[model samples]
Every structure is written in C-alpha cells, then in structure tokens.
Target chain A: MSSPVTTKPFETTGPGKQVLEITDLKVSFPGLFKTVQAVRSIDLNIGVGEIHGLVGESGSGKSITAMSCLGLLPDSAVVEGSVKVTGHEINGTPEKQLARLRGGGAAMIFQNPMKALNPFFSVGQQMFDVIRCHRDLSKNEIRAEAEKALQAVQLPDPHLALKKYPHQMSGGQLQRVVIAMALACRPRLLIADEPTTALDVTVQAQIITLLRALARDHDLAILFITHDLGVVASLCDRVSVMYAGEVVESGSVGDLFANPSHPYTRKLMSTVPKLGLGEQSLDFIPGQVPDMSSPPAGCAFNPRCDMATDACLQPANKVLVVSKDTDVSGKHWAACHHVTGKKPSSETALSETLEEHNA
Target chain B: MSHLDQPADLLVVNKLHKTFTTKNGVMTAIDNLSFDVKAGETVALVGESGCGKSTVATCLLGLQSSDSGEIVVEGRNLLADSKAQGKSLGRDLGIVFQNPYASLNPKMKIKAIIAEPLKTAFRLRGVELQQRIIELLAHVGLGEEHMDRYPHEFSGGQRQRIAIARALAMESKLLILDEPTAALDVSVQAQVLQLLKQLQSENGLSYLFISHDLATVEFLAQRVLVMYLGRIVEAGTVAQVFKSPRHPYTRTLLDSVPSIDPARRDELKTLGGEIPSPLNRPVGCHFAPRCPRASDRCHKDVPQEITEQGHRFSCHHPINAAEE
Candidate 1:
C-alpha cells in the first residue's frame, strides 16, 4: 500500500513562526475510471496562536487537507505536497514516525465526539490510554493529568465525568471530553474539523469560546475546518475560502468579510442568513459544486460565478487584493481574474431575480 | 364545516400534550403546546435538540398521536377522528425531514417517489401522474431530466429539492419542513430556502418550519414559536422575537448565535448549561437551569404566559423592552 514519497527541505520564515505549513498540496484518489482530484495546489500557513479557517462547501477538499496534515489519508490517495506540522514533514513520514508525531505535535477533534470515543470504555480509561500512548506517565499521574485536562475544559465534576461512558455525557460534555483528550498531549497544533457543528448553537458558542481561549493560552495554532461562514467570522483570525478543491480567497477575517475579492467568496458570504438582517432575499450560487473526477476547466467556480468572463476559462493566479507593498502577514489574496479590492455593489443579479420572482 | 367555510388558520395545535413511558419514567415530550399556522404563512418552531420541535412535527403529520388536546386542520380536528380523517389529512399535510439523503428512498427514481403520495391520496396514474410529478419538480427549480435519477445520483441540495417536490406531490396546502436545509451548505441552503419561498408564494402554501437555526428562522418565518422542554416559551412575529427578545432563554439563544460580522468576534454570550433532560422534569421553568436572568421565582414557580400586542412569553424576569 506504499505510495511514492517526495521530500523537501524545511525552511523557517517570519517572527510569528508557523506551526503548520502546507505548500503546493495536491491530493487525488485514483479510481478504476478516473482520478478524483480532491485537492489542487493549496497553500496555507498557520502561525502560533492563530486560528485559520478553511471554509468551503462539502467536497471542496477541506477534510482531505486536514487528513493530509496527519498523514491519515487512505492508502489509495495520491498525495503530492509538503504538509509540515510543527516543522516536521508529514507527506512521506513513516507510519511509526507519523503515529509518534500525531498526538504529540498535532491533534484533531472531529465533528462528532461520540464517534471519536469508544462506547465501551469509560472516559477515564480512554484518557489514560491516550495520555499513556503519548507519555510514560504512572497510573496516578495519568489520572491526575486527565482530571486536570477535564478541569481545563471547565467540565463540571471532572471526577464523576471520567467514570462515565461516552453515552452518559451530553453532546457538549462529550465534545469537551474529546477536546480535553486532544489537548492532553499539549500539541502545538489542533485541527478542529467542524468540532461544533453537531452541537446546539448555545453549546457551539461555548466550544468556540473555549477553542479561542485554548489557542491564546497555549499559543497553539488551530486549523478550524467548517462550512459555517458565521463560525469562521467569529472564531478565525484569518480565513481561506475553498471552492471545488482550490482556494479562491485568503485574507484576514475582517478583510475578507468586509471586501470579499473572489465572486465565490462574495456569493458565499451573501448566502449566509445574517442574524439581524432579516427578510432580505439571500443570494445563492446557481450551479452545484463541480464533480471532482471531471471538474470544470480553469476556475472551478466559473460555471456558477456571475462575474466570470472568457478570461476566467484560463486558470487565475493568486493576486494580492491590496497593493504588493503591503506587509506579508496583512496581505489579502484572491485567485480570480477579477480581484477587485472593493465589495460588490448592493444591486446584483440575484436581487434582480428576487424582484422578478416577487413580481 | 364544508370546504367553502374553511378557517383562516390552516393548522391549529391547542394544548397538545404527549408523553412517552420510558424505562425510567413517563417523559413529557410536548407539554400543553399551542401554536397555529395561518393560511399561506410560515410559522417556525425553533429550539435546540431534544426541545420537542420534531415531536410537534410528528404529531402534526399524524405519525404520532398526542395524549390529549386537539390538532385542528382546516376546521376539522385531527384528534377527533384520526382514523377516519387520516386520508384527507395526508392530502393536506406533507413533511420533509432533516436529512434529505435518509428521507428520500435511494432505490426509487424521482418520478416514482413523487408519485407515491399522488397515487395514494389522489389515485393519479399514467400521463396525469407523470405531468404532476414534472410540475412539482419544476416548482422546486428542478427539471424533468432529473425524474429518472435516483436519490443517490443527486447532491444534497438537489436531493432536498427532490424531497420538497415529493412533499408537494399531493398539492398539500401545509408543509412540515423539519430542518429541511440543516444538512446543506450555506450556499445550497440559501438555494433551497429561496425555492421554498418561491413554492410558498406560487402555491399559497403554509409551512411549519421547524429548526434550531435562528437566522434561517428569522429569514423564512413570518412568526416564530420558541420551544423549551416541550413548552412554547415564547411566541411572536419574527421582528418582535428577534429584535427585542423578552424571555431570558430567547435572549440567550439569540445572543449565542455567532454573528457573521467579524467585528463581533469573541462577543458570544454563551448559555452556561446544556438543556435539561425531559425525563428529570425540572420544577417550574425548564429554562431556569440555563437562563442567565433566571430569578428565584423562576426556579420556585412556573411563570404565567404574558401577552402583549401579539407577542407572548413566559419569563419570571423578562428582559426589558427598552434594552436591545
């Protein structure tokens, strides 16, 4: 099941120091008929204490990108890129070595905490096993560490909580336990793949706040993957908008939200039902996400993008939304031929459609 | 009453009570719940999981019967003659579930799936049934080309559209959309929502929109019923409920939603605790355990429903109307 391995020399840059750096990542699954291009040349970097949101519709290669970071992709996956976690190359890392790096350097919390935990085992047993696998701690020490981790997550009655099975705890409590287990190893990077999506909004807010606090307190870099634009807006310092395998836009959350450069990003932001902005007709991307096996040519979003022109048929380069002279960290980028720094006008084609529909 | 003398209210649920006898004890699923959907109106029943939102839908759909109270639809009480009125009720009501993938039959083609209700309720067959299926699909923004395709062949949004088409197959005046777009992406969700709006306007459909997403509820619903532990804690027009939420639980629920505005980062006023189990049966207000503004009275005695200009809420310590 061994795939061809590629290696690249590690290079460090900037004072913030990156915890996870993905460069020129391309992931594909070779099938009987055709190869499914899941990820196409994605470049992402998350610095210490920064929460970078990887947002996209389903089948946009978000989960694939996250899995590649941990070298957890299926054996059939043809991964070609540099996915470095805590300065360690993950693409061609040996299985034993990858296992060692997983919980120690980077830990991932999934959407469903119950599925992540073993139903048969008590929380204490699972926590002890995970802690023991990462560190050579005594039973008492492990139990103490587990209690401390649970306490850190603000789980009331940590002692009682550890004795309970996954089924016994509520959805929010189970999520906290899962988070505690992930952070027990004190990983430098946390890849939260829709961690709060399953929980209620009230519970989700608590988890979001907890994640933000954890990142700041531990100086941990987080890669928060979700389709929720609102969650990204609230939780992330920076965001990268993915569409059909390629990142169409990347910038500081404020910059992207205020002036989304890519048509996909703009349309996506507009689609989300804003809390106070009630009753306004929401804009929607017309066409479906491209089939990965035989994706549309050039910009994947061209089929659904209203602003697309003949030039959009050719692959667009990642152009800086601001002038090139801007600071590297503050620079905003959009992979579109028409990367206007300004926001789209209020009167768009969608509003026209709404008016026509109303008539 | 005759068909010509139909009431303005499409569906009226009055003091609906449903309880399940579990291994532990009898758990009240819907406790004296009352709400109404007017003709061609969208009344959203919003609450977190285990708040009996789905129970209301099930009861309305006649999948489950309530222990007491009346479910009156179009001047006929469904509870009065559930067995006799079931067939007609099926024609009047249609349901689209939360997960489109699971709700739709994968083995069946779009045409056949949509034809089921038409066949059972109207006994439509041959070209007429085919035409009706196509028409329903067209109404949902899907085309006739999709009729032969299976549920698995369509994406989530497309599948949801198909589900909506099937729900509309019987020319149902009232649709029970139970988290119809919860499983979809934001972009796709917007598409489905827009389609729903279009369908509602075009057909003069009433919708019992059940969801936990407040933003979506506000967008689609003319009125909203905020449920907690099977009780309607608050009920009002979308503007009144969302803009000036009176109940502490309603305020908490509204505040917990992470604003899409990036400037409001880290501003989430999260509720402290999870929803209490219905089996436990908290004394007094069910939301008191999680409500930030819960007073001693809230824990000691249930607050009476207070009504003001069509807005209603049960809160011991309501947030002042002056406060935003």
Candidate 2:
C-alpha cells in the first residue's frame, strides 16, 4: 500500500467534454484455479455532467468494469487497456498516485452503505478525513466542508448526522452520507455502483435525486451502475448494457429503452414489472448470463437471444455499429448480427409489446 | 380459478399487537393489526421495510408472542396454553424467509435439509425418507436425483425450491412467505411465483405473501393488506386495493414502482427522506409527513376505518387530484 501522492486535478476542459474514457479495457483476477476474465475489452466514455448508466443483471460484469476504472480492483487483478480520467491515464499508475487520484480525480459509492461506512467512526470524522486527505484545508474548514457536503445530499440536520455513527443512519441516510463523502472531494467523476439497492423504494428515490442534483450542480461526470432500468431511464443520459464481460449495447437512454436493438436487451425489457403502467414482469431476459470461464464462441447473448442467427453463432467480427433508425442517428450501437431495421422508440417498444399480447 | 368467497378463514389475526421493549422505549412493531387469509387464498402484506410486515409473519407462526389481542389459527390460540401443553405449534404453519441463501443450512445436503422439518411431524424409514425427499424435489421442479446435491450446488431459484420443499414437508396448512422471491431475478422470480401459485391451487394451501413488489403481489394475492408503522392502514381485495388504492402510502408505493411505460415522464414522487424515526413516532397518522395529501386534520386527528364492500382505508383523507 502506498501513502498520499499527487492529486489529478478535476477537468480544465469546458463542460460537455469527456471526463473518463475507456478503450479496449480488459480486467482479470489471478486468484483461484483459472484466470477469470471479469471485464472484457470494453469501451466506455462519459462526458462532463453526463450520467452514463451501466445496466445489466447480476454477473453482467458492470460492477467490475466500474470498479476497475477507479483502480479499486484487488492487487491480484490484472488490468489492461487505457483508463483515462480527464485525459490522465490511471490504470498502470503507481499505488500512491492511484490512491491520491481516487478522491480528487474519481470517487465511488458502492451498493451497500452499511458496509461502506466504518461502524466505529462518526459520519463527521469520516467526511473530515476524506476532506483532509484530498484537500489542503484547515480543521475548521474541513468540518464546514464536511457539513456542507452532508447538507448537499439532503441529510437533514447535517450537524447531528455528522455526530452519529453509520449504524445510527437509515439505509437512505447512510447512502446519502456516502454521497456526502464522495462529494466532499468534489471529484471530476463519481462512480455509484447500485447505490440504492439496500434502500426502500422511497428512500431510493431520494438518493437518486440527490445524486442527479449533485452531478448537475457540479457538472460532474457520473457512472451510475444499476440493474433497475427504471433508475437508468430516470437518471442516465447515455446507457451501456453489459453481458458476459462485454458491452452488448450502448445508446441514449431514450433510444435504448424505446427501441433496444439487441435481442437480449428486448428480452430484458419484457421481464421488468411496469406497475400498472405497461409490461407485467421484471424484464426477465431469457437464459442465464453465459459462464465467463468458457463463454460462447459466438455472441455471448446468442444463447438467450430470440433472433440469433448462424452468423451470431460464430465469433463476433468486431463491435457492430448499429445504425440509429430509419434516419440513422448513429447513436445506438448494438453488437449483434441481427437488427436490420428501425430501433423501437419508447412508444413503439411498448405498443409492439402490447400488440404481441393482443396477438 | 373462481372467487374464494369463503367467510370462514383458515387464519384470522384480530387486533394482534407486538411491542418490543428495547431499553430506549416501547417499539410497537405491530399495532392493532387485523386481517385474515381464507383457505387457498394468497393475501399479500405490502409496505416499506420497517412497517412490521415481518413481525406479523412472526406472530402468525407463534415464534414471537404478541403483546395484546388474539391470533386464531382455526380456533387455536397460537399464544395460549401451548406452553402448558409443552408442545410446539410447528405443524400448521410454514415460513419462507426473504433470503434463500441464509435460510438454508450450507452444511446440510438438499435431501436432509428438506427432510429436517418432516422428521418432527412424521416418522419415515430410510427408503421412505429418500422417496419423500425425491418426491418433494420433483414437486419443486428439481430433478429427483438432486436429493444428494448440497444447497450450494444449486442456483438461487433452486435453493428457494429446497426451502419450499422443506416447508411442504411439514404439511403446513398456511404458508407465511416473507418476501420469498425478493432476492431472485425477475425471470427467475416470475417462475418461482408462478410455482407458488400452482402449488397453492393443487394443495389448496393458504399463503400470507409479503413483499414490497406490488406487481408480484397484485399477481398472486387474492386479498391485500397495506401495513404502515405496524398498523393495517388499508385492507382490500387485490382488485380493490390495486385498482383503487385508498391509502396515501399505498398510492405512493404504487407510483414509485419503476414503470415499463416509456411515455410516462419520470416525475415519480421522490418520497423525500427516510420514514421518521419509528422510535419517537408522532402522535397522529404515521404517514402524515410523507403523504402528499396530508392536511392539518391529518396531523391532528387519528382517522378511523371506513369500509365499503370489504375494501377499507384507515385515513381521514386519501383522495388525490388525479383520482378526483
């Protein structure tokens, strides 16, 4: 483990510019009997103030991808390819530099807040420590900074919350505290990995709103990872759906949700419960995610795909660039041999589904 | 397939109260909660996490004694005289916990784990036990030969099958499933829920299904009980509760459900903050702070129940602009 080092300062670039860029990024764990390819050569880039959602089912390798970006993966894990935050290369950097970059350049809020925050430490102490670690500020200034961050995430009575332990806070509150800690540093990029999974529906909503506000206010690039497409639709600008370590599709939230090009994406949309609004189930994708150990020779989702042809059964040629629509926006790209026509719009995706039900 | 208009209930909970005396103060986990599940009916108990839905499940099983009121399970006082008889009220009830992972013992093989509850109620020889275990495994959609596989050898859905098999082994008349499918993925969750529904019909078993997922509940529950702060805030048939939610809490929960309808703009009521600390609970309605339609009257007066055709809402006001 390395001590403190140089902080990779936040963006000097103008707004709407790229904050983090990943190209052919592959990560693997060297533990166990065989090397496990956790994150395949995946490409992802989030522009400043853009909410990029990594959506997929469990073991879809979304978390591993996000974790790898911050250099949060274990020492046994071998990472390859370029990971850049504000155009500063991160992955192969020394431990001390990487540690310094974590808070100042990038910050992460994990799924479970109870486990994320230390049980013994007061919320205030945790926030102050984070502030002091990343910023050269006085004790009183750090305390004020901590309080403001807590208040930013809408933790009522920030002073009291600071004095309280992690256990004393509710799941929602604890998550907000995590957000507060993350924001205290005001990193250029914030990676939230299922930050609301442990919270109640209502509490989850509050946390999502806080995150969105924080991103908008600070013009911070956010990598929001979640299984719930609803959250993705609500919070994200661009969305990337991962399966078996590789990105199956990436598109604007509206485009992806409306007309998901990949067959697996379509199947996924069918299973999620839409309350009384639309579809009935949690969009249940057909077939389980393929085992990464001996993944499919062809497309990973070909096993689960309803429209998979012989071409898909062969190894993917390259990341297939799916044209946007009849009037190709070129925004929606799906890695599949299928998808010959228009990507379904939100209205079409649903009405077409309703038509299938009626048929 | 038809409406189970059975007036006589298999399980009736009448004003059942469970208040725990934590050193800080009396935490009323379940307050004046009353509802019933008829034979073969699935009654979903839906609420936020700390709304005492789990406590109601506990009281039903006689695991936790209620502080006040009676729990009548087929005219049997679940609380009374069982201690004097030195008998455990283990047979009539079955419970499926939220996590199939934690509920199952990792060390035990699937056969023995499923057979653990049966040994108490019925005596079986080696062949008979093996046969029964095989039967249960098959019944739960597992291979009959899966009896030797340990719980770890199976997926989450399969492990839940093992749990269900154990519950069935006891021959429980009423099943208290506490968020059984919550841990499962939607596709797997759908299959498990469908299995539960099929098992209920075939065995004529009653289920007290508890879940935060309203769609799942709406699909399964014959009747629905809306709990808030350990109280039955609203109770109705599934059609009644879902089609016309009378309580604000139920309405908010429904609204919060991530919709598949893409046209529906996402101004979902971000129910701000956590539920006020359950310890120093306010004097009036528990949902007063969160309720969108909460009035000054709501903050001052405790609302009484107004019933219409078996659908009840305990609120001074539950109307929204959209409904009106």
- TM-score of the first chain of model 2: 0.86
Please, what are the lDDT tens digits per residue for candidate 1 over residues B1-324? 123255388888899999999999999999999888888889999998999999988888788888999888888888898674586457888889887879888889988899998898889999998999889888776888889999998877788888887887777889899999887889888988888888788778889999999999988999999999999999999999999989988888888898777777656887787888899968998888777677788888999999999999998888887777
C-alpha lDDT of residue B304 in model 2: 91
Per-residue lDDT over A1-359 for candidate 1, one digit per residue giving the tens place of the 0 to 100 score: 01111111122245436798888899999999999999999888887777889999988999999999999999999999898888899998899999999899999999989799999999999999999999999999999999999999999999999999999888999999999999999999999999998889999999988988887788878899999988987888888999888898887777677667789988998899888877698998887788899998898889988988999999986665653223332347688988764322433633343223212
True contacts kept of 2: 0.32
By DockQ, who's the top model here? 1
Tell me the alpha-carbon RMSD of every candidate: 8.2, 7.5
CAPRI quality level assigned to candidate 2 from its DockQ score? acceptable
- Model 2 chain A: lowest-lDDT 10 consecutive positions: A1-10
TM-scores of the candidates, chain A only = 0.89, 0.86
Off by over 4 Å in 2: A1-17, A30-33, A277-287, A317-328, A342-359, B1-8, B83-89, B109-111, B118-165, B168-171, B320-324
Worst 10 residues of 1 chain B by lDDT: B1-10
| Regions of candidate 1 where Cα sits further than 4 Å from its true position | A1-16, A323-330, A341-359, B1-7, B109-111, B122-155
